[model samples]
Target: MANLIFPSDFEWGAATAAYQIEGAAAEDGKGKSIWDTFTHQKGNILNNDTGDIACDHYHRYQEDIALMKEIGLDTYRFSISWPRVLPAGKGKVNQKGIDFYKRLVNQLLEAGIKPAATLYHWDLPEQLQLKGGWENRDTIYYFQEYAELMYSELGDLVPRWITHNEPFVVSMVGNLFGEHAPGYQDYNKALQVAHNLLVSHGLAVDSFRESGIKGEIGITLNLNHVYAKTDSKEDQQAKDYCDAFNNRWFLDPVFKAKYPTKLLALYQDKFGGFEIETGDMEIISREIDFLGINYYSRAVVEYAEDELLKHKTIKPEQAIYTAMNWEVYPDGLRDLLIRLNKEYTDKEIFITENGAAFADQLAADGQVHDQPRVDYLREHFKAAYQAIEAGVPLAGYYVWSLLDNFEWAFGYSKRFGIIHVDYQNQQQRTLKDSAKMFKQVIADNGLTD
Candidate 1:
């Protein structure tokens, strides 16, 4: 029996990014993306693995969509590859690329599934990277142009559009930490990139509204509930700074139209200040219809002397961790939803990405008994149900992935999909226990025992 039932109208879905799964890197006149370049370089990805033929989703999307239909996904959230559509990242539209997505959207519709499309998912066109990418203000307008083009091409079909996904990872991980594509290790450059990403998001929203598209537009941010490791004032300050750095820095600009004053002063004192031109804040704070949040795990922070942010996340001892070394904290999802409702906008929130990477092995019987992943999703779903009961207006939930594909810099080393992918065996797919569990969750519109 299942007691925690979601609202009858609650949306259920699975999300996937094109670059991560759609392997047709050079097919259909697609230009190279930063990932294509990054993965090809020496010592960048594990085993130097590239997504050259990842799951072959570009050719196998129909098969994938059939699986989605079987799982009863009410919606399919996918990202459009920037280079795939606009090979040069601007001008010279790739009709074949556009046609691919059109076919994808049409199939989802035929399957009775809504298409929620994301414009950018960290796959900056290689040509755009050559022009300084997000750090360059010109890139903002280029993104707007791409968004408008997509709107004109597929706007009527996609009722939900996400402007950008995880700007924090794009700016911080890719720039500040040098962990992802176009890897840069400069603090000021990262801040500039962050600012430009927000500006571009606003411009896209403005364009969507101008096009009179019958749809809702929003940005998806990877957020986590932050906590202090101890009751000490130093730890509390560290927690606040970490929260500001990860959450408020992006949230405030989108919702409040300004950066957090405390952290803004600190950044200004350290690295000059984020470039803010006239009317930039006004545009950045444009009203959006919903907020998409990607919650994986909570961060626990403690004071650290001689650190840039004066804080560092610390792992709790003896805590359960995912294959990605992330602490599994389902309560964080509940807490984050409640906090967003209390402090951020009143718009509906969607768990745009939520799932765990586990060490999965396919058995001789062509089955994957991934009970841990099923357990992980169950707890997270319970937390989501709790958030809704608390009046958080949580409208939907999209599992982080519908298939196992490239895991970025980690290459194909990690598995986050509920469906097991046999990369060595023709990219064959088999539903894990977790996938079966999720199917029931969708069918029941809630968790089950």
Candidate 2:
């Protein structure tokens, strides 16, 4: 292969979520989040493991920041625990909780790293969830208030603010599939949650603009390239419906100010039409400065008469698979990027999250040799470089995580971080070979084979 170079000004960084890392679950007036509540239930998470002490980031943020600085990262993306800030979900602010993030931001700046903050990353305040969660329209206003508070406190310090990370997962996984926190399984409720999430995103963008914050605001969506299993018309139709369900369900409303007509029509009988109130679409369609995309793998769909969406995903037998059982299809990243640029808005796109999970271990040689992860990242970087060359306004890339923290419902079983964390050993961090290679990639502004 050849050298894969990126734009000189392109950003290089890593991302982590709050509930996944910061493990001061009940410290300093920090109220419980939905994850905290869900993980406590029996058989909810893998091995019944909880994030009660995952990575201990709340006490070791400085150590983590130092690692990021050592990795030559230009930016560090992290989320704020909603319950930590507003313990009761509304009313008063938690000074101690605010101070923790303040310290983290200051340390990042002192280390010459730009702080990218995400408002909500599925860690909804338990109090809010009790009042119907994202399915309730009132949750939108609560999110707006939370956004305003965050901007008032940290807006001037952070350069980039993401309203929400992967709202699709929050809606479909958490609400419809009953896989994640605040788990519920209902189709109508899932649609409601999805709509409210977009509303909240728009409200946050509007609040950011109204506050006159100097930073850019956007929302992150987990998107995938959908391919038909065969050239048959039924398979093609299945692929289109799956795309609308997974990708366009979130993308169209934000970029085009409308839902995909095919999906809307298909779900009309089941959902009884969206509970759209006056000015809801207008708020959901509010423009923003950029769009953040989190791409992992692609889906190959075939027609299924009995499936709810009339589509069933078929995994390719010959393809390499990650520990997450996702196919290692790097070209999917390039295809998705180009499609977004051509079919959606031309605004700048930031890869807010991208990484693979592999069963990594610390060898007796006193090092972690994660060659597979390094190869995965290298191929994906090449795909991103191809997207940039093909006229996609690719701006930056943030690896999915900076540390191997909690993996949601999968719990501590999956490892996605380039830096390995010894969970049983006080969360001891070890920089893997992949981290070293990524540092070099950042230094060179590209990939070297």
Please, what is the TM-score per model?
A: 0.99, 0.99
Q: Encode model 2's per-residue lDDT on 1-449: one tens digit a residue.
A: 77888888999999999999999999999999999999999899999989888999999999999999999999989999999999988888999999999999999999999999999999999998899999889999999999999999998899899999998999999988999988899888989999999999999999999999898999999999999999999999999999999999999999888899988987896668768888888898899889999999999999999987899999999999999999999999999999999999799999999999999999999799999999999989999999999999999999987999899989999999989999878789999999999999999899866
Model 1, range 1-449, lDDT digits (tens) per residue? 45789999999999999889999999989999999999999998999999899889999999999999999999999999999999999999999999999999999999999999999999999999999999999999999999999999999999999999999999999999998998889999999999999999999999999999999999999999999999999999999999999999999999999998999999999999878999999899999999999999999999998887889999999899999999999999999999999999889999999999999999788799988899899999999999999999999999989998899999899999978889989989998888889999999999766
RMSD, one per candidate, in order: 0.9, 0.8
Alpha-carbon RMSD, candidate 1: 0.9
Instruction: State, as a TM-score between 0 and 1, how close model 1 is to the true structure.
Output: 0.99
Candidate 2, residue 111: the lDDT equals 99
Prediction-by-prediction clash tally? 0, 0
